[model samples]
Target: MARVSQEHLDARRRQILNGAALCFARNGFHATSMQDVLKEVDLSAGAVYRYFSGKEELIGAIVAEVLETVRDVQECAARESPPPLPDVLIPRVLAQLREVKPGTLGNGEWVFPRLMIQVWTETLRNDELSALMTAGYVKVRAAWANLVESYKVAGLMPEDVDADAMARTMIALAQGFAAQVAVFGAASPEVLRDGLRALMSMGEPRVRP
Candidate 1:
């Protein structure tokens, strides 16, 4: 018998996570049974059990992956070559919306809507989950804050501009827009993108030398 390497194990874990996301997206957190997840993954019940002992554990992993993905994408955007604050910020924020799982519009309707609703409810009832979500958002906010501060340094922002507050507001707006898109189902991705662009295009009387 051949022994499985750590790389193989890690690949299988990623596959499982992808499958679980699909399953949870379809059936929702409360309605999605372990059996539903089993159908989604190629692994046997015992194999999945080896990683996540229960449904909550599996969901926790999914949530963590989502947060990590957001952090990673934003970090990459922040490192991009020098650009004005609005220019740099727009791409990162829009890229994030473009990548949101279940998606920001269209086909994401059935999957992401239910999933986010479940996560929101879970956050309300589960203190640990709430802490995790808060911490994750804080990390995301910090990345945005750093980029905003960069803009301030470039004189794009007024000296009175609050980078931290603006960053928090940006994140809050994104979250709100996502939830609205999920609920309204009327706004297209193009519309959402334009709205974001408009927000970034806001200007003050100050000019950089």
Candidate 2:
């Protein structure tokens, strides 16, 4: 018997992951079963099980993949001369998401963004998933905070601005945008950028005399 090449093994794993992503995106994590993934990938039960033990493991793998992609985007942005502000950075991250995954349902809905929302919900009940998500968020938030420091160094933002708070705000903004896109299926990245810019442009609040 010939041994399988590493490339062949990697490709098989990717195939299983892609199929699982589609199934979860269409029917959600809870509703999607291992059998659904097997049918989607046109692989035998043994073949799929070889890569993933079950649906939970598959969901964890997919979530980990998405989180890794997000971290890569943040790290790339952080390496820039003066990292982009939330307006530019958030949309850039979203664009990269479109580029990397590029998987859409028949109705033209993006796959990963919708899947992310589902994963967020799943994390609440699953401690392992919740821990994974929390760790991912912490790293992403640290990257954003570093970007905020870059803005301060570049004189784009005030020196006194709290980096951690600003990071949380940016994360919230991005997550809210993803939620909008997932639920309404019509959120505009341009509008998100414009809104962030407008918020940034606001003058200090004043009390009426």
Candidate 3:
């Protein structure tokens, strides 16, 4: 019997992952069963199981894939000669959040924002997923902190600016934007960009007292 090529194996793996993503995105992690995924992909249970032992593994893979995309965006920003400011970087990140991957529903809707919200909730009950999310958060925040450091070095931000604090703020902003998008379906990257610009243009805040 001829052995399957590595490319063939990888494609099959991706096919399963994509099918699982669709199922999870539509019905959610808890509602999506391995059998549902097997049906979605039109593959035998054994074929799907060969790639993932269970739903949790599939969810982990899908979450990791999304985080990996975010990491790639952050890494690209870090490579810039002068890293982008919050207004620029945040919008870029938001735009990425709106991206529709292959496994996502193709109804011109943003599936990732909703899927991610579900994943965040899952982390509360799943220790392994919580750990995975924490690790991914740390890495992404570290990348943002590095960008903050670069801004300080470039004299764009004040010397006393706290990189970690700024990084946390940026992450919060991005997550909040995603939440809004997930709930309202009205938030746009351009709106976020304009809001950030307006806030930055206000200069430092002062107490009215």
Candidate 4:
């Protein structure tokens, strides 16, 4: 078969991805079917298959899209603000996190956090999904490292702060925190804000006793 034009391919792929995200959000990833996505996009099953071979690939695309949004937000935050990096970064990160808040019942909170946890859990059982999640994590961490590095270059951070390590630490905290809130619901945004403010402040010089 002839390959479709790149622009047409991308546009059609995006349509499927958007529909997949909505389906995954409403019904957890495991519960959503390719047929449901086809209906969501007003496409027939064959049309959906043309864009993506299967549901897993569609989910991968949706996750990639979310990761891209995170990268873009972090990038813009780095450029548009003078940072304590955490100050600028947290608001953007938290804004995304807020989508999953228990009270809001927003689509983002329901679909994304739940689907992400599902993906992470599935990674242990499935290698392809594991690889996709790992790649997504690495990309997100790299975006964060660049953001943290901006603070170091500005002298806002202590010279000793390890940008790469700090980036991983940030991702770890978010992953753990999301799991925590999803499970136990102990830490809310206010708790995270105050805690992160203290953690981020470590770079600041301490007063002499």
Among the numbered candidates, top TM-score falls to: 2
lDDT of 2 by residue, 1-209 (tens): 99999999999998899888888989898898888889999999999889899988988888777777878887888788877778898998888777666678889888877887889889989999999888988888888888888888888889999999998988888888888888888667898999989988999889999
Tens digits of lDDT, candidate 1, 27-82: 56778788888887877999988888978888788788777876776676567655
- TM-score of each predicted structure versus truth: 0.79, 0.89, 0.87, 0.71
| Residue clash pairs of candidate 2 | none
Query: So what's the TM-score on candidate 4?
Result: 0.71
Q: Given candidate 1, what's the lDDT at residue 54? A: 78
Pairs with backbone N, CA or C atoms under 3 Å apart (clashes), candidate 4? 99-109, 100-109
- Say which prediction, candidate 2 or candidate 3, comes out ahead on lDDT: 2
Model 4 Cα lDDT, one tens digit per residue, 1-209: 98879999777877777677767756667788888888888988888888689987886776676677777767776675475456446545756744422222252244445555766766788788778777877888888888887877777777788888988887776667667655554455566667878876676678899
lDDT of each: 0.69, 0.85, 0.82, 0.69
- For lDDT, the strongest prediction is 2
- Select the stronger candidate by TM-score from 2 and 4: 2
Regions more than 4 Å wrong, model 4: 1-15, 94-109, 184-191, 198-209
Worst 10 residues of 4 by lDDT: 100-109
Better of 1 and 2 by lDDT: 2
* Candidate 3 CA-lDDT value: 0.82
Residue pairs in candidate 3 whose N, alpha carbon or C atoms collide under 3 angstroms: none
